[model samples]
Target: MNDKSQLVFCIGHCRIDPTDNSITFQMQGCSPFANETTKVSLQPKFIEVLSYLALRHPNVVTRNELVEQVWEGNVYVGTKALTNAIWHLRQHLLPLAHSGPVIETVRKTGYRLLLEPEYEQLNVLEDNLKIIEAKLDTANRHMQFILLFMSALVVITGVIVGVHLYQDNLRMIDTQIKVITQDPGSERYPRLSHNRRWLVYGASQPSGNKSLFLKDLQGDDLPVRQLTSLNSSELRAVWSADDSKLYFASHYLDTDECAITQLDLATNEIHSLAPCSSEMGAIDISSDGNYLSYISKHESDKNGGIYRLSLNTQNAKAERLSCELTCNYEDRDLAYSPDGKLLAIARRFSNISEDIIIRNLNTGEEHRLTEGLEDIRGLTWAPDGQRIVYATENSGSRNGFIIDIKSAQFRSLDIDGMSYPNSVSDKGELVYHQYRRQFEMAYYSLGGNVPSSLFPLLYSGGGHRNPDYSTQAARLVFVSSDSGYSEIWISDIHGEKLEQLTYLKSRVAYPRWSPDGLKIAFIAPDDSHEGNRIYILDLVNKNIFALASGYHNHGRPTWNWQGTSILASTSDGITEFYLDNKSPKVINALKMGVGFAKSSTEIVFSRYDVKGLWLIDLNYPNRIEPFISDQIFNAGNNWVLTKGGVYFKSKNSTEQILNYWDASTQQVTPILKLPRSSISGFGSLAYEPNSKRLVMTLDGFPQRDIMLLKHKLLQ
Candidate 1:
């Protein structure tokens, strides 16, 4: 075969003659030269490389020649790209060529096709091409006339179809609601099998460990079977297309690494597919059962992105799919469309904002479906692929919404509690997890009075967090989600005359009163920008301005005793912002939660990597030592400092208790035994000196269960 003869057909296939038989290589669609019988697919770049090599059969192609032909003389294309393409091409070709290797590699040179492919006659191919071209031209003329008539018919049909769809949309979708699992332990990440006979989910035990369980949905008793016995945490169980195997990701407790595994449902056999770091996100299988898509950072990549792997190939490496050079984002919650043409993903740009992006698998083009949504926990595509249902936090509460992709219009689904959409069946049945959490702000008086709820009469449905008192103004400041978003609110010490301070409509946290009670400082996410910034609200003029700081990940802003400077915590370390200076000064090289003692000579903070409290003296910032050791302290909002010592909370085997650490005696003693509850670091703990009162947010027992929603659309 010669290159001149191969030029007869530019975009078709060729039959290569082996020693025993001939093999066909087809290149007509987006995916070129994929083996038809073996069902092995290759990337477009790899196909181009194979075609370039096959055209010049029996001739060695240099690396430079392959790169120039495949990449079209693109100078920026690195050698790694060509090496990867050739490697994949070799893998795809190895199965078809069973006699020996089809692609022969020359050391320090390029690759070549060993088989001599016979070229079809140029005149015959040209004549066949002309006949096909003439038929296509005739078909185009007929299509023009048919399109004109169809255009008129479509105008009338569209109105009728539009009316019918509007009526369908207006029809009630809610039908029967049933609680599937009511175990006291938390159940989440529900997935239904393709056959609709089994339900699988992850449930948390009393020891805070998770395992996977399978429920027989069609059985009379609806019994649940424990599928996995590993001590590690298992999440997001998805079934195989034939319902004979279950795939899930497991996080090892000891090493904190994650791995995807496949479990044969019948024989209970398990196999590991791939291992990733702790930052791995969601996983999904392709509709054809040939590829598995997931998001993770491989051992070689600097950041995590979407990747695809071939299930049939042994030890197949994941191919990166997401392009991050233009906009850096972390992807999660991958859901493949019903037709497998698009992939929907949740992309996180910052701590507070995330967007849903739809990516074309063939073209690598992305279209963002939702923008500026806060904290998207999970999302899934509808069975028809026309709408997307996602769970997000609205006004500090979790809710689900359905959005039309083309119109960008959304409507809320009326399910209660913190709901997360897990899976939607083809019949429109939905499986989700609903969570209910309750927390009350209790006031503890050190002067022998019992604790009570701060505002019993004005208690709202949403959560109230981070309460602080101002003795000078006889008022208290707190963050509340009662206004549909977390906002700063103020009330009198007696729980009267409540008023809202800031209205940024974003998530606000850790509100603290100034020493002189003239201003309030808090942490609020900058919606227009990135990261959480500290802002001060003037009580007299009602003015809010961001503090002068170069860093963005700042929180827990507390004023000094003299009210001349503020202390805040950042990801890098703790910083001090003076009222007179325009820039913040780095106080200490420690990443921890920080607060000043009553005397202002030292600061008490908690180390995240360690288990105890530490103190840094202002007179000697470099001298930081453990203030209290051998105590398991919660990371945030679990401790406060007074003039004498620190009042902190700790959990024992029985319950959580409040303890007092005396500075002079260097001893610790339990002050109060709190109720059995889970303490979230994001909640607040405050202490008042004048009234000797302690206040903290306690999360009551969480009610988590799996719920099933049946609708008319599912039928």
Candidate 2:
């Protein structure tokens, strides 16, 4: 055949003759050919060379023709390179072309295939169609059988899944729950060691002093050991991976400073790690013991954020992470993943809302795991690393929830009531705190000298707090969780004609009555902003409106006497918000809880760090001074300004006293000794001047204990 004819008849698809068990190559590596006994693998250039010769088998090809077609007219590739490629191709094809020599080198020309090429073609479309139809019929039957088998497999899988679901339901219904600590005092922040043999927790005595204690889980008869006796409060203890050391945060009462310390179990010695700036005491140590994660405020900015401390370094220095020098949100309750590849943090956007966020340590990429979650108390990583188990307020109650990280799907566990998830074991055992709080509103008559329950018969077993009395309507507006979620509720002086108002299903705090009693102002979580905003409830119209929205949490809202403006406390300080103009002006830049006097021109607030009550006169510049000193209190909410004096709750030793600071004589006198309950520092107190009655919420019954639950249903 001539060169032009040979080029036109170049091999296309690789062919095989099953009768002789022989295969012929097309464009060598262009098509991959494999069989039970033989396989052929070749390079692209070799495939081209073989194709040029295979199409013109048994015929000699000129060297110029072979090089031009195979090498695409590239002169730089010498004939020796072609010779090497041909040698390699022959070796690869020898096993497959078993009957004869695959290629033979011509004396002066290029090459020739020894085997006679069998070129097959369809002369009749009808015969070709019949062959294709027979093969297709066989393939369809095989496909039908495969589909039937797949359907059967789907049925079997569905049945197995249904049975598993039924068993899981039964397991959930019959979960084994045991109370580990049944003490009358509060026991919280339970942490299990890596081996699950020891559990450490913070236990508060009835005297109100909290200390760390260790319990032996394997032997119930073993006595509990007190790990900390520093007189200061110690909380959130975490065990080292080897269980030889424990790290926790200690807060000194005198200086009100918090420090992170590590304890050596063998030596019974404690070492200080770092001093924290904020009171949000959150810390976690990694499994490898190389780093410690905690929340701290920067020295320069004083804004709280998550920090990582390197233990292996000489100085054991800490560096800010997941944020710049100043973070907008307070990142607390940090938890390191089991693999130590990610960090989970509760980002406190405002006082009312905190959301869980996960950060990739290596990539520095952050993903928000929850949105608009109010009051996240604790968080821990699940053992499987695919989900995060956290404690947050759901339906006005603290509950444990498992959220899938990838899908962001969350479901509340069956457990209820003020649950703080402490730790999760590899075996799916959960150690958490079940908190029970019972507080009631009582009215103390200044003249009658008697305190009685505001609602003697109306008991709902929910928190009643932040009461404000209306002078015009002779009614009281307060925050209550009686309707499953915290809402603004109003009732008469005797708690009759009770009406539920403002169903926001979010945490409502510091409800204050307007001067004319036509409106009530409060702070709640804003769904659109995901932060605490000032909201006003129009009593007449029964409408609620957001008056202010921002990143800062606005609390302790008190309206002016004219009802033209509202004063509230924020992280920055006391802010005066005008009603007509919708403008906020910072009156005092000091961080404190604020309460307006009867005239509204003067305000009384409590200093958090200094533990003093200060008065601020808005009408006069630089008119701020200490009204009462040497008082240990929670926040401004614990104090209220009455026409007679400023009524406040002060901690004396272990007991809290309701003291009246006389407005006329400026003398502080104890009015009543509060009942010993687990009232946290930030308890609610309010006084009505018109009735000469003091309406306050005292911790009537508070019980907290560690609980252990074993279940396989969560998976």
lDDT digits (tens) for residues 27-88 of candidate 1: 43213244433232334565566666766676899888877776655322324457646654
Q: After superposition, how far is residue 585 of candidate 2 from its true place, in Å?
A: 2.2
Candidate 2 segments exceeding 4 Å error? 1-157, 163-173, 252-257, 277-280, 297-301, 322-326, 449-457, 548-551, 629-635, 677-681, 689-691
**Most accurate candidate by TM-score:** 2
Provide the clashing-pair count of each candidate structure: 3, 1
Alpha-carbon lDDT, every model: 0.70, 0.70
Q: Write the per-residue lDDT of candidate 2 for residues 339-453, one digit (tens) a residue.
A: 8999998888778778888999999999888777777878888888888888887444677788889978777677776366756766568888887665566666766645542
Residue 607, model 2: Cα distance from true site in angstroms: 3.6
Candidate 2 clash total?
A: 1
Extract clashing residue pairs from model 2.
28-47
Give the TM-score of each candidate: 0.69, 0.73
